[model samples]
Target: MAKRVLILSSSPRRGGNSDRLCDEFLRGAAEAGHQVEKIFLRDCTIHYCTGCGLCSREGRPCPQQDDAARIIEKMVCADVIVMASPVYFYTMSAQMKTLIDRSCARYYTEISGKEFYLLLTAAEPDRQLMLRTVDTFQGFFDCLEEAHLRRSILCPGVWNVGEIEGHAALQEACEAGRNC
Candidate 1:
């Protein structure tokens, strides 16, 4: 039952807290014999969705020529999708949101039945601070029929880059991936 796992790391900062957790999750997933790939949004050229409605209108391809479509293709083929982001202003990063928006072309049909894992990090210590962020992810999940949220790791109080170097949540993230 090896799953094709895709980890989308949407941290603007390279090696940021959330990205670190993503790495740990990747490591654990790999150790557990899952086929894993981690895509860093910072390295991808994903443009913002313009709501042009072309994607939804005719089931046509997105007019914007960017990496978003390719990423969506990967998501469509993945059995498990892990979206990791640094909580920005109580929500997922713009990169993650934009990617989700751009998936309008095939989300309902192609992105169905996938297991999702949410990994988020924030400066706020209270886990409740991430509720809004979780809700944001849930909004996308709700659209994809049978796309269940399998797990969520909220690592709070880590703001600066590399701050999660020794955080215990890193291990928790790894364990989550291992158990996946």
Candidate 2:
């Protein structure tokens, strides 16, 4: 059966290491006959999630109108979700964090039972140190019922633009998507 794959690229820098990994993953997923969509969060008007209680009330809607609603809708419908981010300060990017925070709207309702792939690129050289960053993404999954962290690719020491070119992590990402 074909699956719906949603790749969320949260790198503010266009064509950044993590962004390129997302493309490779998309390529492999598409080649495998899956319906794949890659959304660059930098290009989307995703506002910071206001701590409003409207979504908690029945029949009340969120007031801050932005692209988060649409993005969350796609996340809810996706069978597989790929979240890619360039690690700054040893964590996911601000864009990715915003999206995760905005997901509070449907976290308790529909953000469940999905497979996730976490892709991260960091200037830090230690893989274990990068795992600390991956922990942030994993923490989100821990909150979701039946959320499966199917795979992850950590490209460490990739600070400069195009530093990740020809890196084996790209192939790993593609293989993970192909095997998805």
Candidate 3:
């Protein structure tokens, strides 16, 4: 069966380590006969959430009109969600965090119950340190009922744009996506 796979690449810079892995994942998933689409947050005009509390109030809709709602709608429709981010300051990038915050309106109703796969990259070499970023994602995962974290590929010790190139983790990402 062909599954709908939506990949959110949150790297502020295109072709960044995590984003590169997302490309590989896309390639593998496509070869596996899945309908895959990747959303590069860098290209999207995502406005910061204003916390107006309207979206929670009976279809009042978000006061700020931007790409967030559209992205959330795609997220709601996807069978698999790949969240790829480059970790900085021991956490996800600001773009990814902003997207999560913007989803506050439809989180419970729309963003829950999907298979999640994480692709994270960081300069820190220690896997334990990288797990901190995964832990951060776990906090978000805990809020979404039935959100299964199927797998995660963490690429540490990568700082430059092309630093992660040719790494074995890239192949692992392809394999993971193919299996999905």
Candidate 4:
């Protein structure tokens, strides 16, 4: 069945390892006949969450008038959500974290029943280094009912831009999207 796929690429650098993987994933998802959209965090103006609790207390809109609400709305509508980030100090990038935090306004209701995928890249070669990042994503998953983590691609040992080019993990990412 055709699905709506939303990809959040949180790499600060354009064409970075994780961003490249996101591109490949988009390609595969498109080829598989899914409607796909990729949002690059570097180009979006997402403000940090201030934790004012306004969203929770009064069901009010987030105080910050930025692109986050629109992005979260897209996330809410997607059947599949792919979060791709370059690992920084064995964790997801700050931009990705901020985006996740900004979803608090609709976390309880808008974000649910989606198939989630994680694409992480880091300088460390050990796959174990991504465990904490996975846990962080799982923490977000725990808040959303019926949301399932369908797959993850940890492309480690690639720090420099363009280093992910020609890597087998790119193909794997594409396959993951194609099979989604």
* CA-lDDT, candidates in order: 0.90, 0.90, 0.90, 0.92
Write model 2 residue lDDT over 73-143, tens digit each, in one string: 99999999999998888888999999988888774468889999999999878888898888898888888
Each prediction's TM-score versus the true structure: 0.96, 0.96, 0.96, 0.97
Model 3, position 37: C-alpha lDDT score: 99
Compared with the true structure, what per-residue lDDT tens digits does model 4 show for residues 1-180? 999999999999988999999999999999999999999998999999999999998889898999999999999999999999988876789999999999997855678899999999988888897888888888888988898999989898898999989889999999999999
Better of 2 and 4 by lDDT: 4
Give the poorly placed runs of model 4, Cα more than 4 Å off: none
Q: Per-prediction count of colliding residue pairs?
A: 0, 0, 0, 0
Model 1's TM-score against the true structure: 0.96
Error of 3 at 118 (Å): 0.4
**Candidate 2 residue-wise lDDT at 166:** 92
lDDT by residue (tens digit), candidate 1, 26-58: 999999999999999989998888888887887
**Pairs in clash, predicted candidate 2:** none
Location of the lowest summed lDDT over 10 successive residues in candidate 1:
101-110
Q: Model 4: how far is 38 from its true place, Å?
A: 0.3
Better of 1 and 4 by lDDT: 4
The alpha-carbon RMSD values of the candidates against the true structure, listed in the order shown, are 1.0, 1.1, 1.1, 0.9
